[model samples]
Target: MTITTTLEPVTGPFVWRGDELSRTDDWIFRLGPDQVAELEEVGRRFIADDPDLRTVSAAQYPLTAAAEAIRRFGADMDSGRGFVLIRGLRMEEYDDTLAAAIFYLIGLHLGEPIRQNELGDLIDHIVGVSDKAYEEGGLPSRTRDKLPYHSDSSDAVALMCLRPPASGGLSSLVSGATVFNELLARRPDLAPLLLEPWHYDWRRQDPDAPADTYTSPIVSWTQGCFSMYAGADMIESAHRYPGVPPLTGPQREALALIEEITYSDGVALDMDFQPGDIQWLLNYAALHSRTEFVNGADFAHTRHLLRLWLRRDVGRPLVENFGKHVVVDRSSTRTEDAVRDTQGHFRIREAAAVRTDWGD
Candidate 1:
């Protein structure tokens, strides 16, 4: 299918609750062995060409017919379903360098990778770096605990699992649009709270960043589309500010209703991720979470997933607050700072941007 770019918002793109959708086929894409080989060849060529142009953009990794499929995948993130599970790669077959490069190559096909944290990590590993969980200000990307249902600070996010746990670390996702609709259906009174601007503690997304916090509403409506910028932990952290308003009784009750419905049977979909599984989510439309898992002792059996935060062209028009972790904004001159480890694994140094990023 030929994809055409447009800035106009797609009105109320079909929203569905967990009970309403069940088939993995609705969103999952499995790459056949031949396609996998072709992608690997693309990675090899990308490396052979520049050998230094790592993780810059998807266009760097030239694709043949595969480009169309990947573009279709991205198109779905905006115009069709808001999430997709691409399975069927044998991660263990490849070493870390090749595996990571391949994942980054796929990400480049989607969009330019943005700084994931103040650390400026373009690609991140989703395994605990410390014992602390995100609730205590530890980075969620490096936590082993449960992540609350929240939209990530990006236009889209991709996770390619290098290794999965033995059991109990299923990824859970709920439609943010569904949450928006549910708030109105159950209690219109609380629905307005979602549109209320709320501050979130930057929590060290940047160490040298100027502000301690930034504000945005949970839900935004613009260009005939409803976009969500929500993170329960961030909203709860906002209470530390004296000026920030507390969640009113109606807001609290409203949030409770949404969460209740989310975890309820048939309302949320939990995924059993396999090694080499790539999960892509449109951050604006999907509220995602992760459950706790038992980690193995060694690298082979341990849980590790590479994460990418990409910003595609033609994103929905958003409000001012929407640009907090702004990747592409009106005033921004950003340059990436990156280097590889002794093992040749790519690492993101601290980054600098105009305003796409607010915290360290």
Candidate 2:
């Protein structure tokens, strides 16, 4: 199936200033006070119902209620901006265990409720985070980090902020579909290259997977819906292989064009996250980015957030070679560590190595 970009002119450009994006009357989803209270109550019960669910790890929680919430609300949720951020749903005073539980519950509510093992499988294929550290690393922390716009290994990705940065670390987003549409309208010749398969470095992969790379297209069409996976770093790495040809001038130009649109006012959105606020987005439909941030003076006061990748029940089909951990059939699963190692090649040499004091 050929995926086409559906570029429609933006009614208005998204403006970002500090931690807040401009408010729109056309939000895809907004939680009322009643809904927020209900969600909190559900979170409290979720912890109480499963004593074994709390831990520092993202994978430790039982996600029954949270999954049910996604199953109930995901389809009704808006896809444009292709995201939602629910502010003011406090759970900060709770212990790490309770906080983790709350994060999992919120994820379950907004996403398809798959087992932690399933989440691990996707992480192994995408972010390469192992199952053991999933819970701890799932939360946000203030640090000089640069994550480009790329899709997670799931239909949707969600993050619940427990704290905001003392400075910097703003979240940015752009719609891949919107970019494609614009390119199609202005540069039709370049569209085909985006739909063709490209290689990715799998930089987060464990050493045992062979010093090779994985391949997939930036744009894919399955079940009549469009999906994308575009990251310039990964795309450039593919050229190192003997058989792979370099990206054509037009292809490179197309990528640059998309990046320009993404960074511009027409398609991008930026916001500072606050405690108790949860942001959920369609992974394939949008590109997400984060700015580097500084840490507070104390460890306990550092910025932190919890994240999850979810497979929506009603979403499009997986293209071949797209989901490496699970069969395209979606019938099997494994622990994230078993499928692949989560540790990156880079390691901190000392305690201060983890500090975010350097310039971006």
Candidate 3:
């Protein structure tokens, strides 16, 4: 698909103003030298105090301090800059388990903490990396590779870089609001089509359940706020199931326009991640992507990152058609039935969850 919309250059800092977007310094925050040092020290000690850290599978931290940092740094959906990419944090120095633990700790400090078990389930759903594969591969394919632009089940999402790609893996971000604004200005007639629900193919399904597809709006507005979830492959897959509507020509046009706007310099921000860097974003507010990359030949040198999907207690409501599967309780787990073939370069293994060496 091709986008025909002409776009204006993005100026000013990216800021979220209600449901709209603008550029402003108020929404952007950077950690100072002292804070960065404090964070590193805290991370180091957390690993040291819990020597079985790699085996440990629980969230252990002071909630007040973590919440304070999140509030101060503007880590909410309404805060509009939508994303923050922290550089200089390296994950390779620690073991995979410790690396994941560190990510969990820092993420807990950033938002309302969810249990490790719940986190584990969510991770399994998002990445589908089983316990055995985690032991062997060290991480899942979705995370180990350059993840495409997609939103996870959260108001805010974060990733801590443990081991970065040896070469050619850069993080990219685009504002959904920016794309909508560009569309509203350039192609007013197609704007409303995006506000309606579109089908999504849930590729990561369990074996027992029937193959099912879900529907969600690519763009939606509620209480004067807007949210979105747009992915080319996922949206196209929805039609495979019975009773789902096909993509309309205008919807296709709008999606193509969105791709153009997001990839263009006018709406996108690109950065190369360094080891130890932590990147977080308001998932509903921003669309993110990564460039394809190659891991080093050695297992020790392979690229790895830890991810967390956080529900912002203070976040806005999802449009009615979106968020159908977003159950509030942490215990809910829905499996998909999409089959996997071994044709790709990478291999995917199916295994059950295992008890971590670190006791809960």
Candidate 4:
């Protein structure tokens, strides 16, 4: 039975920001000597094993802090704020190898690592790798550009800061729930557009990869919970494909409102990064962005970050047929024929709860 539905608004711990979350330090977990030592040891072991980046499994790199922090972090992602910052990583003490091992282990505790793309890379480098031409459809992470509020394509997205640029890389986060609530109050007319399956360009999602375009809802409601797959940059690029319908004027306005609220006042919680810090954001309930940054001349001084896009073996059920890693349904995947001429016949992955490394 085919059914078309709108996202039904729901409540959760994620529907908060500003005053509702005033203390920045509350979300921070500063590492003490014991935890730092634990990480350093893990890093040493990771390099000693000489495992390829792709082969580094969390099981081999364990953590003393894992049992408690990872447990709480999982719950927080599932039911709390949908985001957290792990502070006090001693990046200055270890080389890149050890530092990444720390990040990898923590991610493993949270969920299984998914390849960011067909290249099968487990870690993505988030730096201004190159200048993007106007036609390149630059991604904010790959360039020194500002990002509009958008959710990542994974169930959970994480970034570990290795270095910071000279200035202007502040991160901004807004609650998808708050954005939804404000829409209902201010622009109820345009809110439903999010529920409809929209075209999302993959592969060429950035300069690093090339692929095809697929369709999924920007906002999906399933099991009485709201899940979002929003990326203003990607959404805008989807229009370039002839297969996707051009966004309506009202849709543009709705996007504008989310961006407006994201920067407008106290709606988004902004934070700066310190070396060794990990920022984890739940792609489902939180929208995130960063300001443009400038790098200094020294290569060592340039900003370097390691990124991970995690998928739990089990997690929230999605209304749209979202797959394990890519945002599109694996089954209802759009083919070249479907994308160009045939519109709605794409297959969506059969709906089911994802079972993460952590038991459901």
Task: List TM-scores for all candidates, in order.
Answer: 0.83, 0.69, 0.70, 0.83
**Model 2 whole-model lDDT (C-alpha atoms):** 0.52
Error of 3 at 181 (Å): 1.0
lDDT of 3 by residue, 1-360 (tens): 112223222322332232222243343345555554555566666655653322223245443334455565454344536676555434445555454544656655556433223223333212322333322323234333545466655667776666666676677777776777787778888887876777775533222223466667876566545666777655765676778777788878887877777666545666666666677877777777777666677744455555566666555666775743433323233344212111111100111122233111
Candidate that would win on lDDT? 4
Model 1 segments beyond 4 Å from truth?
1-13, 48-55, 204-209, 326-360
TM-score of 3: 0.70
Misplaced by over 4 Å in model 2 are 1-38, 48-73, 76-81, 110-143, 205-211, 241-244, 317-319, 322-360
**Clash count, one per candidate:** 10, 15, 14, 10
How close to the true structure is residue 158 of candidate 1, measured as C-alpha lDDT?
A: 89
Candidate 3 positional error at 221, Å:
1.4
Q: Mind giving the per-residue lDDT tens digits that candidate 4 earns over 137-213?
A: 55555677777777776888898888888888888888888888787678788888877776666645643234457
Q: Per-residue error at 146 for model 3, in Å?
A: 6.1
Q: How are the candidates ranked when ordered by lDDT, highest leading?
A: 4, 1, 3, 2
- The lDDT of each candidate is 0.67, 0.52, 0.53, 0.67
Which residue ranges in model 3 land beyond 4 Å of their true spot?
Answer: 1-60, 63-67, 74-77, 87-93, 112-140, 143-148, 204-211, 327-329, 333-360
Better of 1 and 2 by lDDT: 1
Residue-level error in angstroms, candidate 3, position 281: 0.9
